[model samples]
Target: MFDLVYNTIFFASYSNFYGLGNITLGLFDVILAYIVTIIVSILVALVLKVPLLPSKPYRYSFDVSAIYPTPIIAIGILSIFLVLNYTFMYNGIVLAVVIGILSALFVKYLFDFVFPKPLDADEGEDM
Candidate 1:
């Protein structure tokens, strides 16, 4: 009974599984890619002089941080590439680094243009 269960679970083979052609990425590669993503993002953020944390105490702050959105954005982009079967031959690592740098640059330069601050309603009002 145990042998049957083992065979069914681990050894049973299908002709075509998910149409992905039995793509089983090594654990080491996946981990390396993630580490690369994190390291590159933090480095780029530091080079750009982005803060390590948000400036405002409130939620939805406009400030970019070395530890927050940069890594998140990097990982998100990496995930998309991984799902599309682009992670091969250490390509994932390279992609991660590129994404990290791009994200940091975007935060430094384009974030404000893309997400402008709200105008104050009481501005230029005379008391």
Candidate 2:
């Protein structure tokens, strides 16, 4: 979990360091980061059979179609960059890539605080 947070911070900072020569590219990177985070979070949720750390119920009602798109787009972009950079650095070990993916999941949970889809709309309304 710590590793995911650390790597996400590193990835964000690294992306920022590349300078803002291309607005399109910058947007792409942001979207990619978001997507990577979401996908990893979902996978972690399934694998762990629990919400990742820092879980908090969402404010809005559930909408499966609406839920997934943003993260997918974000991850797709960030992944392209991670692959380009990490491949050169680590020589493509599967373990390293898996770690990177896990790290992405960790960051998603850390920053976003996603909880399981609520069973009742009124479940946490008192809070």
Instruction: Using TM-score, give the best candidate's number.
Output: 1
| Model 1 steric clash pairs | none
Task: Name the candidate that leads on lDDT.
Answer: 1
lDDT of each: 0.71, 0.43
Put down candidate 1 lDDT per residue, 1-127, tens digits, no spaces. Answer: 4343223223212222457456545555666787898899899999999988998773856576888778988877876666555655564677878888998898788877987766556685446
Q: Which ten contiguous residues of candidate 1 have the minimum total lDDT?
A: 5-14
Backbone clashes, candidate 2: 8
Model 1 accuracy (lDDT, Cα): 0.71
Q: After superposition, how far is residue 98 of candidate 1 from its true place, in Å?
A: 1.4
Summarize candidate 2's per-residue lDDT along 1-127 as a digit string, tens digits: 4354345445544564446323222344433444445655456545544333322344452433223433444355445555334322322233333544565454445424554455675576555
Residue 7 local lDDT, model 2: 59
